[model samples]
Every structure is written in structure tokens, then in C-alpha cells.
Target: MDKYTGKRLDGRYEIHELIGSGGMALVYRAYDEIDDRTVAIKILKDEFLGNEEFIRRFKNESKAIAVLSHPNIVKVYDVSFGDRIQYIVEEYIDGITLKEYLDQQKEVKWKEAIHFTIQILRALQHAHEKGIVHRDIKPQNIMLLQDGTIKVTDFGIARFSRSETRTMTDKAIGSVHYIAPEQARGDLTDEKADIYSVGVMLYEMITGQLPFEADSAVSVAIMQLQADPKPPKEINPNIPDGLEEITLKAMQKNPVQRYQSAAEMLRDIEEFRRNPSIRFQYKYFIDEKPTKYIDAINTVKGTEQPVYNDNYEYEEEPVRNPKKKKKSTASLVITGIAAAFLIVAVGFGLAALLHSCSSGPQDVPLPNFVGHNYDDVKNNPAYKNFKFITETKNDSSQKAGTILGQNPKAGTVVKSNSDVTLTINAGGKMVTIPDLTNKTQDEAVSNLQQLNLTYDVLPVEDANVTKGYVQNTDPPAGTQVAEGSKVSVYVSTGSGGEKVAVPAIIDETLDAAKKDIAAAGLTVGKITTKDDTGKPKDTVIETTPLPGVQVAKGSSVSIVVSSGNKSEKSIDIFVHLPKNVTHDINLKAYLGNELQTEKTVNPSYNDVCQLTFTGTSGKKQLTIQLDGNKYQVYTLDFDAGTFKQDESYPYTENSSASESVSGPITPAD
Candidate 1:
């Protein structure tokens, strides 16, 4: 009956004050005499104490979570039933619940959204691994610590709420706008259900809005079954693409389609966190109109207008002729008197109103409310009327609750009772970033996931961090990246990791050259040749990285072979010269400034002649004479000593020189 302050309960805890009261219990900030520390003690509400089922569930969950040792989960210290009452002692938290934070912020930035998501994910991951699913995962159950860390409370309370001993009906259990679809349907719940709730929280955090809504709770539940909400990007375009995909995937209707495991989803998002660009492509569908409502509205009977009663002032006045001017002098005199009285009455009323307006509270200077904690303002009697604009930021410049900057500058003049709006800084402040290089793509992603970062993946070549490892990342690390930023990672798929062989290019013609390369899983780059070889130009003579040698992707392989010049080798090639091949129409031939040592020719073409020789000056030459004509000559020119029809002329070994050129060639005139 009295205020709860410093009154010992059951000789173990001294209740300092009643901190809060809810539907099922009264919470007090108490000192545990045994431990000599401040602890939060929640005594079951009077209504619940009488129900055995409620007491049993309360005892079970209290013991269950009290033993839980997760960093993200709230820890219960003790659970006891004494003096015909059940109470649970828990570690006192100094920060506000996530619901309080979300209530303060209608819309959170992508960075904040991701940061919150990751924290929730970590907590969920732990719970899922432990075989405990937080059936009711919503903002109200999440808490935001001063250090920018998150804590999840009420891990197993939903199951407790299922018992008949609960005060409120299950119908009113979950906070509006956050209950998952299956929970509403009373279906079996698992980890996927918790994930769905988290997705809803994420959607709300980023957009300051909900994806689905309805006039009644039932309709909202039904909407969840059939309607897919728009992606966060549609709500707030600033939301990172990867984060949006992560959110949508978590909220998928089919449990199987949803995350298979909390860790798996976390890993994927973490992978995305490494390269935020690898986004999930969403396929959205419009809702089909319900036929039941449409049919009812269409089939409704029509109504007709009712007739007015004759006696209901329906008669119209007869029109007066304009020419019939006014004649009543006494009426005019009365009208003047009435008008004068009205003026006097209005003048006095105006004077009274002015007199009242001139006597209001003096303009008092506003106090310095910036940087002051919310509780300080919320508790003050004088400043109780002082409007509070609470903001949470992840800033290294100031403490979590400390204010960074304020509006209306402190000490400004204002009406004494008027509520002044204060603009406090959200602590998690940040900016651009630095390079994330020399890290594995997985490692980079894990960091980003923890940092609530988003990035894209671009395949890049690198000697470090092998394939699938990060080559480098854009927005460079430590560059003050804003929360929810897209950080792109160039992962080294290490040149796709496999090598295609270099095809045989020595004897192939230009056309066959490319085909062979293709067959070997390789492609041609640039083709070069040496003239004076008497072979077709553009023909693949030899390949760099050389044939049969393995090379990395995109490596250039130049095909160096022979030019079109003919002398030491030719096929169906004719030559013109002076009529009398007079004595030594002396000539010299060379292949790209080199003597052709091994050359060949076909004896079938008697008109053709070929030779591989060294000149008198120690220079190599190859010249041919056909029917008294100097067919051709190279830099290592040879004298037209004799005109020979046969003898299987000189040429290069295994030469495809006799082959004609083909394949997408640019013809020469």
C-alpha cells in the first residue's frame, strides 16, 4: 500500500523504489543484501500470483534465462517464490529499450539499421544454436546500450505467455506492428519465426515505417500472409542494397525459403557485409483483389431520395420589384441605432481581449539542456514541461547519451510554459573510410558485418589473398565510413583459378590458328610475322607463352610466324622479271633480317623454285627463277644461276606455307 523504497523483501533484497509496473509484475530497483549490489527485482502482479500455471512458467523462464550467459542476452540473477509471491531478480540495465529508441527515431539510417541487425543477428545466432528461439523478436524486447551494443531481453517469455495463468489474453500479447505471421496463427514456431520478427524490426528501423498494416489486428495478420512488403530501398532509397536483400530474405513467407540457420544467414550477410554490392534480387508481386468484398459492394441494393414535407419551410418569397423604392423612415432610424450599439459592444470586447493578451508570463531564458541525459529532464518538475527530443548516435566524440550539438542555442528567450524543442546528437557519428586491402574477402566481410558496413564484389587480380580473397575494397578502411554505407570489395577469384592450354601454332594457317587456340581453351591476342620467309603473312608461326605452356587469364600470346613474301617458299605463286634473266640478276633474301636456314618447296609446281643459302658476303639469300624469270628473292638474295623446274624446293620444316590463308581476313588489292 505504501511507496516501495528501501523496504526489505523476504530478508534478502531491500527494495529501494518501485521502478516500473506492467501487466504481470511490478519492477523495483533493489539492493540484494546477499550480494551487496543493486539489482532489478520484478514481483509478479497480484493477479498472476493466484494462478499456479503463471507462477510455474514464471519460475521456469526465470531459472532458464538466469542461467543464460550470452553477452547479447539479459542475465537473470535469481528466481524465488516467497511470502505467497513470485519474483525474479535480474541484472540492472542502464540504457533504454530498443522500443524507446525506435519511438524516438521515426527513421534510422542504413548504418544504424545494419548495426542493429547485426547485433540482433549475433544474439539470435547464439539463441538458435542453443535450441532456443526468441518467438517474439521485436524492437520492444531489444535494448540499446550506451556503448552502441545491443542486448535482447525476454528470451523465453512468449512460451510463458502461452500458459492460461497470463493476465492479458494471448490476443493482446505482442506489441502491435511487430508480431510475426505464424505467431498470430498459433502455428509451430522455430528460429525462422524469430528471423521474420527481426526482419520486421529492420524494416521499421530503416524506413521509420512498417511494410504491412490494417485497421484491425486480424487484418494486419492476414496481410502478412498474402502481401509482401516493399523492400527497404523502396521505403528509404538510402538503405544499402545488400542489407535490403538480407531483410527481405529473412522475412520470406516460406520457412524453408527463409534462412536455414541463423549462422548461415549471418554468414551470408556477413559475406555481403564484406561486399555490400552482392545484393539479393527481389521479385515482388501485387496483391490480388478479394472477390468477397467486391461482390458484396456490387450486389447491395440501391437507395432513393426522400421527398421533403410540404410544411417544412418550403415556400419561396415573392420577388420585389426594384422600382418600388424604400419608404419606411422609422425602420431606417432603428437600424442606425442598432448599428451604433453593435459598434460600441465590439469596441469594448476588443479592449478586454487586448487587456488580457498584454498580461502574460515574462520571456524567461531557456536553460542549457543540451548534453543533459533524458532521465534528468524527464524527472525534473520545473522542466517536466520541457519537451525532450532524444537522439542515439554512435559517436566517438561524445558519450552515448551526451549531446553533440543543439538547436535554438541554449539561453534563448522563450515563453515560460512553452515546450522548447531540443535537438540532441545521436552518438554513433561517422564519415568516409579507408582501403580494406590485404584481407580475405571473408575476413573483410566479417569485419564489415560487425561494423554494419555494406560493400560490392568486383573480381580483381592479385598475388595476395588468393582467389575469393579480397584484392582491395573501395571507401578505404578507417576513412570514417557512414553507417549502412556500401563498401565494394575486389575479390581475387585468382584469375578464375584454372588455366587453358596454349594451342599448337607452329604449322597452322592464320584461319586454323585461332580455331586451334580456341580448342585448347585459349584465345589469340596479336599475330606478328617475319617477312622474307616466303610464308603467308598473319599465319601463326609461333606463340608467346609458347604453345603447350600454361599461362594465366588475359595473358597476351603473340603469334610470330612468317610474312607473305615468297622466294624460299611459295605455292601457285608466279614471278615476273626482265626478259633475259641476264647473267646474274643478282638478289639477296632474308627473313626479318635473318637467313632462312631450313626451307622447303613442293616439286609439283615446276614453275616454282626455292633455296636456303648463304651469300658471298656471309649473308643468307634465297632466290628463285622460273621460265627465265626471276620468280622471287629475299634479303639474302641469290643469283638466278639456273632455271630449275623440279627438285622439291627449299622451305621451312612441317610448313603449312603451302596452305591458303582463310578466316575473317581483310583482303589486300
Candidate 2:
């Protein structure tokens, strides 16, 4: 098992098992205690923690997805880019990757392929419109749910089209077999490149083979740049003509000939879906030879018919009689002379009209531009006579790119061609700060960047918080701040107290782990038992504050030992008591019918009491009594280490019966 398999991160994501691994990250199936849901966490591999390039790529994926919210795209809930570890928490997908499915079945039906392609295209359309390009669009990055839904994921190599222009590497950035010709040539790529990759995937699905194959990736890249893929029909004759046309059009070697945008491609797919037999018959003349015109007698017209020239424009044949042609030419010259004189007269009239208005430039009232898109207003033909002098300011209250203020106020008469200054809102919008506690400096900064916010990191000595991780943020999390706001992030140095690394106790016997903890100058806190079929009884399977985490010496370390697949597991629950009771009360806690804890407590002395509950790893009912009157009913989650006060009853001093109540009870201290 991996070291993180049974560990918890940030005290919220409980890593259960390693589900998948990629080139630079490992994916784990974890349970989110705070959200009470299962999530998939992708952690950057330990080897690349110090590699800046890999870290950038890892951060890029989260940044790319943070701005995109589509049904066919994976959702990112959290991210942590600590110095030692980096991870992204995303929605758990209970499905297989498209690559895995393709491996199981070499080829998919054409209709099924189209269905999948449509979803992928929809996802790309959303990303493209947001100025994002998923350079890597291959089967490996596509997830297929059991219900036939397609999810596009893995944006590690994605690029923002508006801000970024060139590729980071000299070689191709994506899979060689699926990348566009321009990508293989190391040319600047855009949304069209993603369309090409989608086309390649469609080809593989329909033909059950790659378009180009060679001994090495470099050779395959060459093929992508120069080779023409065999038509899908040749490999699979059942492919619809229109579908084939769409695929080939998308796979065109030149970007100009390919689908301009994902939306444009979707329209073609929609047309085909409406009518399967429809044929676009799109023609390309780039590779064809010049057309040859053969001489033939014109049956309808005794004179030779007009012939097409190299430019595809029509030209009349030369006349055979010179005298007749000369007469015609002279007539044409006379008409040309008359036309030239008419043009000169018209030009003089226009010049006179312009001279009349030359005294003063044409003037028009300046129209209101505030609350309108600056680009729309600037590009409007009505405003063409005026030159716009644009300035931008960060105003989170207004929509980005919208005109916030205009000089030469609306209704003011401004001369034509006059420079009008317009102030546009540059800040995107306001965003609520997400919980940044326990996140590392890099992770917090990345999150701030995603929201268009800036940050300053402050390293403070804190013993309660992990070293190198965020202890808190200025204004705290959940505060709604405008975009571009500077937030100060406080990071823990773990130096306020003498710190010791939590000794590795996973897989060790409970007695052995206890001895290790004692040797490390830490006392054993609580030992919880979980039913793990993979481990032997009494073997430690997990630990609190995880191994290698630095904590103050003498601090209590908790361990979770395996019960060896027992029918039931042991759990600990904390029962709250009223601390201001004037007299002693009999406090009894019952887990179902079994009495777990029975004690006489003076509420003024003890504010809380601990109770042990035995049950399987699921919700269990707990009944607590105050002086024989049912005080509260609680539901406990053993696996998540959480509980909810389902029902509460008010207990008055010397009251004979329990009074019904609402909400949770607070321990009066």
C-alpha cells in the first residue's frame, strides 16, 4: 500500500486507497469528512516536487479547471500545493477511462462514437469560448461513466489562448498520434488544434487503429506533420459519408481548412445527426492541378462561348474579323471617354461638397457607453467617426471589459474623429475566498491567482499548524473580497515549540507502535480499531497527524489498528454535558441497547465525557440520558469520525419529564 493510502490530508480528505497513477501524479479515492462525500485526490508524485516545470504543469491543471464548469468536465473542489506534497481534490468518478474501455473493446460502433464525440465537443466548446485550449485531448484523458456520459479531464498541458501564445517545448506538446500538424511542427496552436485531436480520437474509435504508426514517437510525429490518414471508410465501410466528411475536415492538415471553433464543428455534427444521409461534399482545391478547358463548338451560340481563365473567371473569345473588332473597340473607347468625363464631373461635385464642410468637422452627440461592453461599443459603426482613447481600472463591482466611465460625458457634442477617452473595468469580478487553512504557500497563491487575487505570504512560528502550510489568511476565508485584492497569507513555521517527527507506525503491531511512540517522546493518545481485511488483527493501519509530520514533543499521537475484518469495529464518541448543573446527575450513554458509559458526573466539573461505541463502519444511533430522561439522540459516522445531533430534549433542573427541543445543545461552560 502507498504511504498516503491510509493517511489523511488537511484533516479532511481521508485517503482510502490508491486508485490510479499517471506520469506525474497518483490518484487516490478519498472521503471528504467535511463535505460527507467521496472525492478523488490527484497528488503530484514525490519525485517531481522539486521540479519547477512539473509543478507548473500540475498547477496549470487546477487553474484551467477552476475557470471551467461544464457537465462533461471534471469539477475541482480543492487544491494543496505544499512544498513537500501537492494534490487536487476532485469529484469522484465511478467509471473507467475511455482508453481502458477502448482497450477492452478495440472498436466502438459508429453511433456510439458519435454520441461520445458530441459530449467531448460540447466540453471543448465551453473551454474554447473561455479562451482555454486542451492541447491534450486523447482517450486516456476522457472518462466514460456507466450511464454513457463522457467527462473530459486532465488539463495539465492546457493553455490559455488569450494570455499564452507559444508552445513551451520545441517538440510537440501533446500525444504525437493525436496532435495537429501545426502542433507537430512546433507552431503556435489554438482551439483548432484541439479539434484535430478530437478528429484523431474519432478515427481511432471508428477504425480501431491509429491514423499513423511508427517505431518511435519522433517518427510518428513526422507522420502527423506530413502523412495523410487513410479514409475511415476504407477501414470501416459502415461509416456514414457525412460523418467521414466531418472527421476528415477536422483532420485537415492546414488549420485554415479545419473547423474554426468547437461550436462550428458541433453545427456540422448536428446537421448530420438530423439527417444521416446528408453529404456536405466540401471540396478543397489546394492540392488539385489547374483545370484544363477543351475547345468545343457552341451549339446554342454560333459565336464561341465565353471560356474560364486560370482564376476561374469568365473571358470572351477573341473576334475573328479585325475590321468588325476595330469598330467595336472604337465604340467602346468612345463610351469609356464619356464615362471618364462623367466621373471627373462627379469628383468635382464631391470636392465642392467636402470644401463646404471643411470649415468645421462633423459633430455628433457622444453616446452613453457605461454598462456596455467596451469592445462592442468601440467596434460599433455608429462610433466609427470618433477615435476612442481607452483606459482601464480595476473595479470588481462592474463586469470585466465593460465601460465604467467615459470622458466627454454622454450627450456632449463631440467633433467627428475626436478622441474620446473611455474607462473600462479591468478586474474580472468579486469572488469569495475559499478555505485556505492547512494549504501551503504555493497552493494558496495558486488559488488566489485562479480568482484573479494577489497575495503576500507571512511565515510565523506556530506549533498547532503544520510547518510550511497556511495557518490562516487575512480577512479569513469565506470573506467576499473583490478580484485583485491583496490578501496576506500566514504560514506556519512549526518553531514555537520543540517539534519531533511523528514516527512511522503504519503496519506495525499495536504494541510495537506504542513503543515507537514512547521512544519518540510522544504518549499514545487514542487507539481506534477499524475492520481492515488486508491487515492482521491488532496491526496499526493508520495514524493521526500522519507519519513524518512535525509536532511538539510530548504531544499525544493517535493510532488506528486493524480488527482483521471483524463483523464490528470500535469507535469513540464525545458526549457533551451541561457544565452549570447545581447538583450531580446520573449520565448514561447507550449505543443502541448496550450501555457504553455509565457515570455520575457533576456538570460543574466535567464539560464533556467520552463514550466508546461498537458498530460496523456506518451510521449508528446513540442515545444519551440525563437523570433517566432522554437528553439527546445522535447519529454517529464511524468511518468519517463525525456525528450529528439528530434530536435533542431540554432538561430543566429537577424536571421529571424530558421536554422536546430543537437544534444542537451547547455544553454550558
Candidate 3:
């Protein structure tokens, strides 16, 4: 048996059994005696009690969870630090980790993936806004309930975002496969790092595979640093293009290129949820520079050669005469003057040609084309000299083929035949609304998103349909609605029955109370029994919401039952002091061999110290000891508040002393 299975901590929480174990802690399913409810206690592992690093992480987890209170985030109820143990009490979640769910179903549907991702993002969004960053985020840290709710868990490594000088260890901290590049590289991390992990999880959910995986964690970390995975659509063609874009965009290698915050990523996700087919024109900038290639021959010493011109021919001549040199100089001067005149004449002719081309046509003013059709503008005789470039976009507010915008504003001067870019509206894409009646809210949402449409959900009390399912949608099924159009979806809020007051069931039999509760349109929830004086055994003592409280028609009502009045009894514990003792001595009392209390007394002033204990009636063993030595043992009948001698021991000094008290010992007030 586990040491703590039957133990009570701080005289309150009773540990039942170990439910989970991690690197630094052990989680137990415990009951809070004070609160009368089940809670999960995460106790630091015995081996880590003395380890400072583990202790810090254990406390960090408690502090991190304590500050966050979101529907999708696990909640911390209490924290305790003791000499031998440290533990945190958190809400007991009855569910499996998302990792287990993924393992059971390797490939999750895209719509289901989005549902989980949205909850995770919301949790992160809340944590980030509070200046906390969950340095570790993965499916293993997410809890999935049966009702399709998600609770993010495990913030052991979370850090405060405002701590500018904080830095992680050189070794990678988070799970290698889902870690961001900056995290893997041991660089400063922020909210964008969590976004990257979410993207990886989305990829795995839709593609049934991790973006980067290798045989070892180090190899995977390396892959995260330098490798790029194939787009999710390649593995799962059913994944929508826009979702793929969002996923890859979040996984960008550069932190700045990824979503700057969880809210930013959530916006993209919401946009995708509204219009799955809506494509995002996300552009990433890459710096590039021109390169010049030089010939290797230009660097070789012996390869250098003199330049030769075909236009001037040279002839070798034997020693030239002085007279001939003078004649040649005069001839060269005359040739240079004639060449300069020829060059001037050519320049003048070229300038005259350029002026004629520049004056061929006057600059034309750009005409307004925002409201005109592209075809009419393209074929207009007056604008025939201009070159038109067209781009099409879907716009519900404009007619098909209508020009929506132009490059230059109207009245601007532009050269004739210059390029003019026009943005033309291609008309809104019409999509048929799928039948949503009887479908769950999530399913209905997925259907609408697949058609690039938005939805406004209105929850109304419904008698026929189940809660959270779509009752009906406005505009009806089969209607051809334009993309991005809002569809009003009516969601069922369960049966709309009349509210009924809970009747008093105190002091009634358990069976009778259950029947009365059921007749009042309520169901019995958790039933607990406690000792009470006013009620008999098996009688209902009270209800969770109390009597006369209003509740929904079919809501569950928890009742406390009586286990009969407890029999009270008292015991006198006596301890004999040694004559040789001169300093203060301590006397300890035990009931059922468990320490109840201890008292310190000066042995010089008194020889005998007495203590009394009162508790539930039962046959119990009473043991009293002095200075860590066994003194006496007795069988106490707590029902009769009496006792009989079981065993006795003499003082070590060989002195005779009374081991049993003749009368009841009065407990100190």
C-alpha cells in the first residue's frame, strides 16, 4: 500500500490513492473533509523534496495555475509547504489527456481539431494577457473532457513575461517536436512561441503526423531549428487551404513572421472558422542582394594581354627620321580636329531625334474608372493609347466585372501608353447552406465554415432538440447565400420546463428523499453520509442547494445523509517522570497508535503529567510515552469513557510508579 493512501494531511484532506505521477510530483485522488468534495493533490515526490530546482518548479506550477482562471485552463485551489512535503490542491478533472485521445484516434477531423485548437488558444490568450507564458505547451499538457471541453494543464516551466532579463538554460526545455525554433535554439521566447506549438499540434491533428519527427529528441530539435515540413494539405487533402495557411504562418521560422500574440492567432482562427475557404494573402519578406561573377583569368598574372582595336591598324617601321616625326605630329593634330567635328555633328542629330520622340504626344490625364466596367474601359477609343492591367476579386458590394480601384488617382498626369492597374470585382461567390437542423453547434459551425459563411448563434430553450444542437437556421437550408454572409443559427438550450422549488428532505429516509426529489423534477447527484445527532441512520440531513431553492427542471441535487449520532468518549493518558531528569520533559499521547498531541513539563516541579483525549466511540489502544521511551499501554472503551490495563513498563531508574490513573484526568482548558 502507498504510505499516504490512508493518511490525512493537515487534519483535513484524506488521500485515497495515487492517480498520477510525474517527474517531480505525485498526484492523488483525495477528499477535502472540510469542503465535502473530491480534489486532486499534487505532492512533490519524496526524492525531490531536498532538490532546490525541483522544489522551485513544484511551487512555480502552483503559482502559475493559481493566477489563471479560465474555463479552458486547469484551476489551482490551494498550496501548502511543509517540512517533509509540499503539495498543491487543484480541481479534479475527470478526463484523459489530449495525448491519450490523439493516440487512440491518430487522425482527428479538421473541424474537431479546430474546436480543440480554439480552446487551447483561448487559454493561452488569457495566460499571455496576464503576463504569464506557458513555456511548455503540447497535447500532453491539455486535458479533454467527455463534453468536448478542453483544459490546459502543467505550467511547471511557465515564466513571467515582464521579466526581461530571464533566460532559459542552454539545453532545450520544451518537447522537441512541438517547440518553436527560438525555444529549441535557447533564445528569448514570448507569446509567439506558444503559437508555434499550437500550429504544430494542429498540423499533427489534421495530418496524423508531427511536422518534424526523428529517432531522437536531439535530432528532432535540430529539425525544428533548420528544417521545414510539408504543408498539412499535402498529407491531408481534406484540410482547408485557409487553415493550412494559418498553420504554416504560425509555424514561421522567424518569431516576428509568426503570430505576435495568441490573440492575433485567435483572430486568424476565428476568421477561418467563419470562412474556411477564405485565403489569406500572407507574405514573408526575404532579403536578397545582387551578385556579380568575375572571370578567373582577370586575376592571373601571365594571362594579362594588351588591348587591340581593329579600327586602327599599326605597321612596324624601322628607325623613323626626325623630319618624319614632325610631319606625323602635324598630321595627327589635323585628324583629331576632324574627328571632334564629326562627333559634335552626331550628338546634335541624336538630341534632335530624342526631342521629336518626347514631343510625339502630350501627357494624358488619368480618367476615373472606379464605377465603370473593365470591358468598357479596355475598349474605349479615347483611352486606347493606355495599357490596362486587370486583377479580379470577389466583392459583394460591387457588380461583376466592375472596376473597383485604379493605380493613380483621377486627374493625375501620366505618360501615354503607360501601364494602368485596375482592381475588378468578380461578384460574390454564392454558396448553398447545408442542412443544420438537429446537428450539434460544433457540427453546424463546421458546415457553415466549409462554405465560407459566418454565423450568429442564438441559444433558445428547446423541447424537441438536445441542448447545444442547432434547432434551425434563418434563410433555411438550400438557400444560396453569398460567401461571408451571416447566418443566424438557433441553438437548443434543452427542455424549457417550469422552475420548481426543492422540497425539504431533512430527517427523512434516504429512499423517501430520493423519491421526493425525483417527483420534484430533480435527480440525485452525489450522496454522502455524515454523523448527525438530529437525524437517524440512512436519513437525509440536507441538500446541496438547501430547501426552498429554485433549480432547473432536471438538474442534479446532491444530498447529505445521516450515519447516526457519533458516540463520544474520553481517555486519561498518564506519563511518569524520571527522578534523574532535571530539564523540561515532553509527554506524548497516542490514540490507535497515532500521535494526538504532546505536552512539555518541567520534571523537577512534577513527577507525573496527565493528558486527556476525546473522540468517536470505539475500542481503541492508548499509549503514553515519556522522553521517547515506551511507558504504558491500555485498552480504552471509548463508548463507556473507560479503560482497562493492556500492558505496563517500569521506569529505567528501577523506581516503582503508578501506570494507571484512578480517576478521570481533566483536560487543560
Model 3 lDDT per residue over 291-361, tens place: 22111101122453422111111112223224422223458778799769976886557545644645366
List lDDT for all candidates, in order. 0.58, 0.76, 0.74
Give the Å shift of residue 176 in candidate 2. Answer: 1.2
Give the TM-score (vs. native) of candidate 1. 0.41
lDDT, residue 26, candidate 2: 83
Runs off by more than 4 Å, candidate 3: 287-669
Among these predictions, the greatest lDDT belongs to 2
lDDT of 1 at 219: 57
Q: Report clash pairs, candidate 3.
A: none
The residue-level lDDT of candidate 3 at 81 comes to 91
**Cα deviation of 500, candidate 2, in Å:** 42
- In angstroms, the error of model 3 at 435 is 61
lDDT of 1 by residue, 1-669 (tens): 223455687788998655565656778878988988989888886546655555655675675575457888887888888757778888876566777666654345666677888888888777666566666678877877655678888653544223222222123235446655555544455667778888888888888888887775555655676577886777776565667778888888767677767777778777765544344565645346541211001111244221111011011222323563453466878978886897688655754564365547567777787677544454454564345555545655554445554555688887655656554444454554545676776677787877766666555444446766666666665676555656766677554445544555666687888777765556678777675543467665555654544465445567777876534432221222233223223222223444333233334333223333333222333344322222344232232111222212322232232233221111134
RMSD to the true structure for each prediction, in A, is 31.9, 30.2, 31.6
- TM-score per candidate, in order? 0.41, 0.44, 0.44
Which 10 successive residues of model 3 have the least lDDT summed? 306-315
